[model samples]
Target: MPGIDECLLEVMRLPGARGAAVVDWTSGLALGTIGESPNGDHEATAAETAEVARMAAEQPVFAGDAAVAGPGTRTPGAVPPHPPGLPGLAVEDVIITTAPGYHILRFVETSFDSSVFLHLWLDRAEGNLALARMRLGDIAERLVLA
Candidate 1:
């Protein structure tokens, strides 16, 4: 089990890894980040990745299209009825395409109440998608962010 900093270092050890960030899906915030990219801002990149997770969690289809019980539906621990399946939502990982690279976001289930995720940026030209996915899965299991 490794901490956030060590996890980022391990991700960088993967071949072709450019940059990495740990984001909180619920709040669209970066918990930690490593490396750098020539493509402008890292915080913004992390923020967008968090947004992606938030959007996925909010999709009606994923929640079985049941009408949410309230005006403003909230995620877990927000004083509203729990979003169906969210307590058990199992996202292995997510991959998105960029103009110059591929973004891999791996959700990590931690001991804490909030969900955390790892965001990795890789150069498409140099990255192996399949291998990256496998490695991210392994890393997620090994993560012990207490």
Candidate 2:
């Protein structure tokens, strides 16, 4: 398994990859980063992305299995009047695409309840979304936070 720096470097190998970062979504903080940031400020980018990830993860609508979040997950419980019962969820990744680029946020599976993910930004012209998504999945599983 590779650590943050190495995993990020591997992510950059994907075609059209412009920047990458290992972010702790719980705190909107970057553990490690490389290449250019989506907004030129890695800190701001990390914080912005965290909100997206958090919104998705925190919503019970996305829950495949509550157990999937596990014990250490910082996810505060979600509440909505409409749905009487919600199933637990297993979120593989979150992808946001635009005319110029794509941002993929693949959640890292860790031993502890983790709120971390790998953020990869790629240019739409040269990037392959499917391949990038697949590769990011592999990289997420192999990422070793310690």
Candidate 3:
């Protein structure tokens, strides 16, 4: 399996892919990053993305949803509540915005419970959103950190 650096490299290979970063959703820290603009700060972006994910996970609507519910009624796969200013959502992947560009955030389902994800920034003009999503999914599956 490829590591985070290799995964980001693959993402950069995608058409219209401008930059990519592997982030820790819990702490909003970047594990690795590539292709970012000189002035474009990825750390802040990762932090903000993490906050969004956190908020989405905590919302009552998302938490109450049956899809997020685990095997039994007692067990829920919902995101835990966070402190103020944090997102309350459980983000699986693919957050796109027309204003800036396509922001793909894919959560890493690892055995260690690291709560990490891939944050990809792509140019809408040259990027195929659907293909990018699919590729990211594939990359996520292949990632294995040493």
- Choose the strongest candidate by TM-score: 2
In order, candidate lDDTs are 0.74, 0.85, 0.73
Give stretches of model 3 more than 4 Å off.
37-39, 67-91
Q: lDDT by residue for model 1 over 1-146, one digit each (tens)? A: 78888888999988889998888887777788899843567778777888887776556444522356544454654433434334544355678887778888887765566578888898888888889888987887678876
List where candidate 1 sits over 4 angstroms from the true fold: 63-87
lDDT of 1: 0.74
CA RMSD, predictions in order: 6.1, 6.9, 6.4
Q: Decide which is better by lDDT, 2 or 3.
A: 2
Ranking by lDDT: 2, 1, 3
Which pairs in model 1 have colliding backbones? none
Deviation (Å) of 5 in candidate 3: 0.9
Order the candidate numbers by TM-score, best to worst: 2, 3, 1
Model 2 clash pairs are: 63-88, 63-89, 64-88, 64-89, 65-88, 65-89, 66-88
Return whichever of 1 and 2 wins on TM-score: 2
